[model samples]
Target: MRRIYHRFPQQIDLDFELARPFRDVLSCIARLHNTHTTSKGSGGLVKERMIIQVADGRTQFLDLDDLIPLSEKTSEAVDFRVDFQRTLLTPEKRLPVAENVFYLRIVDKGPVTECYAAKESPHGDMDAMDLRTFLKGACE
Candidate 1:
């Protein structure tokens, strides 16, 4: 059987850069904090141990051990993105441009798993940048 990282109670802090234009980061935060999940059958019929409460929403089953390493990796990568975006957008500060954007993402590199964002706003067309690459790189 394959081992999957189950959802677990976690406190996460996400940050984005604000050098010029602004960006939306709320939706991704909401999604990350409110999703429900459970882990079962990985070890062949063992009872679950941990639960995740979404503060303002539902409950979920998750694993604490898996989150520790993942969270560490995520935190390091996020800081890198913040620095990159700030340097890139510094010259383009303008209205209708989101100055800062940040959110949480859940990534499962397993069969039937997926990538999700907490909040998002439409990133308008503009050369000199690709938002998807920035976000995806941070998460991956």
Candidate 2:
């Protein structure tokens, strides 16, 4: 007898640096927050999370609902990262295709002696960046 397997969700990920701060790296979450992702949901970023390394060598995190104020001055930050994720349908013609996981990432780090803002923007200039996407789903 022959056995068959059913549909299974596929995990996919694409990682690359924008090479630009996203307007350039500031090595701090505050500068990142003030940049493009300033918006949420329909206005801007669909989803996001941040991890920052402070002067004491500790880590701090922020979510979409909790934003760090620019006036707080995180200029001394040594490292930072941004994770954005959403779900979309895979392009496979196979049956039972549904929205799956997709992610966008940006990360930067340097010696504690360097300044973060002085670095180049990798993926943060919102208006200057570009992405190629295809329309897929049962409807299209």
Candidate 3:
């Protein structure tokens, strides 16, 4: 099993600990496209897409070619949305149809320190003291 802790600039940090390996996540994404194609019983072009949402709110879309390289052990982040699409043969013509969508957020905790030490006080003001003071007391 592995654990992942993703920290945001202002938002709360997310902690994810799962039994599945990192490669399994990528495989699952690939399976989405496979299942859709098999179930549809179509030989049309199936596209496996991924949309990565950065902390700054920027989005980057990727195809299977782009995602294959990212399935390495060195990948520290897996925060993205996945979509499965295929060409559909309607009564009139062929059209692109979205089969499914999925969201994932898993960051490796390999670089996180065992203990975090705070030197300066946190900026937030609570009652009278800052957030650091409040946390220090609460942790103790």
Candidate 4:
């Protein structure tokens, strides 16, 4: 499981962070798209969303309801939302090496097997991100 932190109150300032595999996954999404800014600021998207699978192997999209505070959740389970604009920060190309950023997408069924898809189809065909590669090189 991956842990992501996000700001509360949609009207508040935008911010968030991802850990391990999830962070890696998001980084790939960002790199392919060349994403760098959002309504919140230059940082990646701030919304929270997660990829889920049903017993039948069908994929489900779950959004973290801002009305409910995440701290209220018990040990049973947890829920979150996804904000592509905030999650995928723009990479600094000025450095000797480019930094891995973040990206947003809607996978068909499995988050792992799916290829990098653009945030929006009408926007055009952008590079698809491979979560595995992001996980390997994200950390300096």
lDDT of 2 by residue, 1-140 (tens): 11111211123133233232421333233443323222343333332322232222233333323433422334322223233223222344322211122222223333212211211233342211222121111011
lDDT, candidate 1, at 94: 19
Candidate 3 lDDT tens digits, 1-140: 22122441233222234444545544543444323332343654444332332212234434444444445522555544433344555556766654333333555454331212121223321221222232233233
Scored by lDDT, model 4 comes in at 0.28
TM-scores of the candidates in the order shown: 0.23, 0.25, 0.37, 0.20
Clashes of each: 12, 17, 0, 19
Superposed model 3: Cα runs more than 4 Å off? 1-18, 31-35, 38-59, 86-88, 95-100, 109-140
Model 3: worst 10 consecutive residues (lDDT sum): 113-122
TM-score between candidate 4 and the true structure: 0.20
Q: Give the whole-model CA lDDT for all candidates, comma-separated.
A: 0.26, 0.27, 0.37, 0.28
C-alpha RMSD for every candidate: 20.0, 16.8, 15.3, 14.3
What is the Å distance of residue 52 in model 3 from its true position? 9.6
Clashing pairs in 3: none
Worst 10 residues of 1 by lDDT: 76-85
Q: Which digits, one per residue and each the tens of the lDDT, describe model 1 over residues 84-132?
A: 1211222344122222332333333322223232222334232213434
